[model samples]
Structure formats: structure tokens, C-alpha cells
Target: MQHYTVIKDHISSYPDPIILRKEQEVLYGKEDTQFPNWIFCTSMATQKEGWVPKQILTTPNKQGIAMATKDYSAHELTANQGDLLLGLEHLNDWTYCKTENDEYGWIPTFCLSASN
Candidate 1:
């Protein structure tokens, strides 16, 4: 008779959720008072959270901004310096983007946010 071994796995190692530290104080949503120390993924990354100021740069296109990723080149979109990327909608798909100049289009997700 042979004994069998089982391996259990869990998502504990998932990268700790990140929160945008604003003005040296962590901004919490109206409902986050309970988990004061925890970074809620929902509120941290969502449209309802409003636009968080981030330092982003231009992509290889040399035309727009770079939404960068950990691997490869960042997704490129049309955004110039000092441009205010408005609303949480702007954070959505890399494709079909509209900048402050009203230039609508697409880009890559790898295009890095300069703040990140």
C-alpha cells in the first residue's frame, strides 16, 4: 500500500493591496472606518475613488503618456506633460482613451505611471 500526499494552496501570497498615500495620510472611504489599517482593494482601485494624482510619462510613441507595467514596455497613449487625466473612467481600458486635449484613442497597459 502506498500513502498519498496532498498539497493545499491559498492566495495569502497575493501581493499586498496598495493604497495611494495622500498628503502623508491614508484616505479612507466612508465605509473604511472599520478596517482602518487595511487597504481595501475595492476602494483603492475604482472609479468611485475619484482621480488620484499620479506622475505619468510619455510612452515610446513619444506622443502620449506611458501607463507602465512590471514587464515589457508600457502601454502608450496620447497625453502630454502637465495634462490632467480626468475621472476614474480614464483609468479603464488602455484602448479608446481621451486626453485633456479631447484626443480619443487606445494605448498599452504597460505604459507606466511615473508615480508607480
Candidate 2:
């Protein structure tokens, strides 16, 4: 199994969100017919110390990718360790975040470390 990481430290808001897509072809000879498998996601939520993660919207809406509704688009999704995050805006130290904004497209280079 492949290991993943959820950039929990970069979160900057609440109600995080993620999407999943099924694989059509087997990359390493793995046989599985699960449609809409796990892909990637983005949300916002302040951690224990006001750490917020940035929400990520898809670039071109991959296969089986479900788009969030306007009502629930602002909601934050839950993320745990090994969730696999790219990066967004900087908060301070050991923390960064991103989000799916109407104006700004996909920002995958924002990051903030934790303040020790």
C-alpha cells in the first residue's frame, strides 16, 4: 500500500473537502474495479492553535470528481495524518493553508511553517 499525508498543519479554516476517482488502467498490475477512488481534496479549518488549511479545487475536474455545491462549498473537510497535501499560503511556522477561491485559481505553492 502507498503511504499518504494530509497537510493538516497548513489548514487555515474549517470544513475541509476532498474528492476521489477510480482508476481505469492498472499502474502496477493491480486489479480493482472501484470507480471514483481516492484522488485529492482541499478545505479550510483552524487547528488547535488557529492553524488553517487551504482548500484545493481541481484544475480540470478529473474523472469521477464530484464538485462541491455552493451551499456546502464553504464547509471544511476533515483531514488526518498522511493525507497528502500540496501547499498553499503561509501562516507562520509549521502551518500553511490554501482554498478554492472564485478569484484565485489553484494555488499550490503557499506554505507556512510552525512557530516554535
Candidate 3:
């Protein structure tokens, strides 16, 4: 099994239950699994609980921000340089995304580039 760092905080939903983590262990999806954009996985702590493990949907598109970009309000999310963001929606010069901490906001498209 491979492992992947949590580039962004993920809150699992039923029938997949897990928690936000800094890292997670990867698992194979079901033999009949059909989603091309998802990765089946479980957190190390969740595995210790002895409950049935769950799946994490892989983000289809991810990008790295070139520099820190701030939103208008202090309460809004800000993307620091080298931060990975999960692409949600793109509109002209901005892209709405979920930050590594699970905070959602729009960032300038110029600040983003394909993850290396």
C-alpha cells in the first residue's frame, strides 16, 4: 500500500467515515469501484479503532499557489506560497478551492499552476 500526505483537510462523509489528518494510509478501492477520481483510504488512527475503513475521493485537479494570496476579510482563507489547493471551480481569473486546512476561498488564477 502507498501513503499520501494530506495536502488539504478532508472531512469524510457516510458511508465513508474518517477524520482530518496530516497523513493517511492508502487502500485499494473495491474490486467493483467505478469512480475514477477517488482513492480508497483510512487514517492510521481510524484503523486502530477496528471499525470498517472508508474511502477518500481523490481530487481530480490540484494546483500550487506561487505566493500567499489573501481574501478581503481576515476570516476568509488565504493561500500561502507552496500550499496545495484542491480545484473546485474556475471562473476567469480566480479559482475557488479548498485549502490544506479545509478552508474554502477564491484565489487568483495567476498564482496557481499545475502541481509538480
Candidate 4:
């Protein structure tokens, strides 16, 4: 899978839209995106999956970035500026990513800077 970095803060995991709909059909016999313009993706590190806005995901022009836009606390990590991250997938403005510490979560797209 491709890699990315955490650019924004307060990124969290929701249900994968595709899987959510599939589960909805299985559990309640229905399928839905839950919200308009939402999409789905799976995490790379912990394999956590979730749904996000369609506008969050974007095609990266470079490898990744080296800093985080805000302080993030997850997976036993406190991600601050200069933390290395790998982009696993994109969902709208959110990017499913894994940190150098192997922590996984979603981050905003604008916070990343493609590695040179």
C-alpha cells in the first residue's frame, strides 16, 4: 500500500463506509453511506477501518511528510511536530496513516508535506 503522513489533528477512526453498508445489510438488511459524500478505507498499522468524507482522500505527489499539524494522542503515542508518518489510504480530507511508532489513525490532508 502507499504511504502518507499526518498533517492535521484530532483524526479518529469511524466505520469503513463499504463495510458499514455491508454490515448494515447483514445486520439490518440495508445498505447506506450513513452520510452524504462519505467514503471508506482500512488502516495500515492496526488494520482499523473507517469511513470519511470523499473530499479527504487525495492523490499524493510525493512520499510523505515529517510533521503533524496538531498534537495527537493514540496508540500509546503523543504525535507532535516532526513525527514521521506513513499514509496507508485516503478518505476525503482524512488520511489513514501509521506513525513511525506504529500508531495508526486518520489525519487531515493539509497537514502533510510530501517528502523530497
Q: Report the lDDT tens digits of candidate 2 across residue range 1-116.
A: 11124434333343332222232111111112331222233222211111112222222234423332322222233344444433433222222233222221121122222222
| Candidate 4 lDDT score at position 109 | 59
- Compared with the true structure, model 4 gives a TM-score of 0.42
Worst lDDT 10-window in candidate 4: 22-31
lDDT of 2: 0.26
In angstroms, give how far residue 62 of model 2 lies from its true place: 49
Compare candidates 1 and 4 on TM-score and give the better one. Answer: 4
Q: For residue 81, give model 2's deviation from the true position in Å.
A: 2.0
Please rank every candidate by TM-score, starting with the best.
Answer: 4, 3, 1, 2
TM-scores of all candidate predictions against the true structure: 0.21, 0.21, 0.34, 0.42
Cα lDDT over the full model 4? 0.42
Question: How many backbone collisions does model 1 have?
Answer: 17
- Candidate ordering by lDDT (highest first): 4, 3, 1, 2
lDDT of 1 at 111: 37
lDDT of 1 by residue, 1-116 (tens): 11111112111122322323322222332223432322222222322222222222112234322232221112234444344342223333232234556643333223324221
The regions of model 2 sitting more than 4 angstroms off are: 1-4, 7-77, 94-116
| Best candidate, TM-score | 4
Full-model lDDT, candidate 3: 0.39
Instruction: State the C-alpha lDDT per candidate.
Output: 0.28, 0.26, 0.39, 0.42
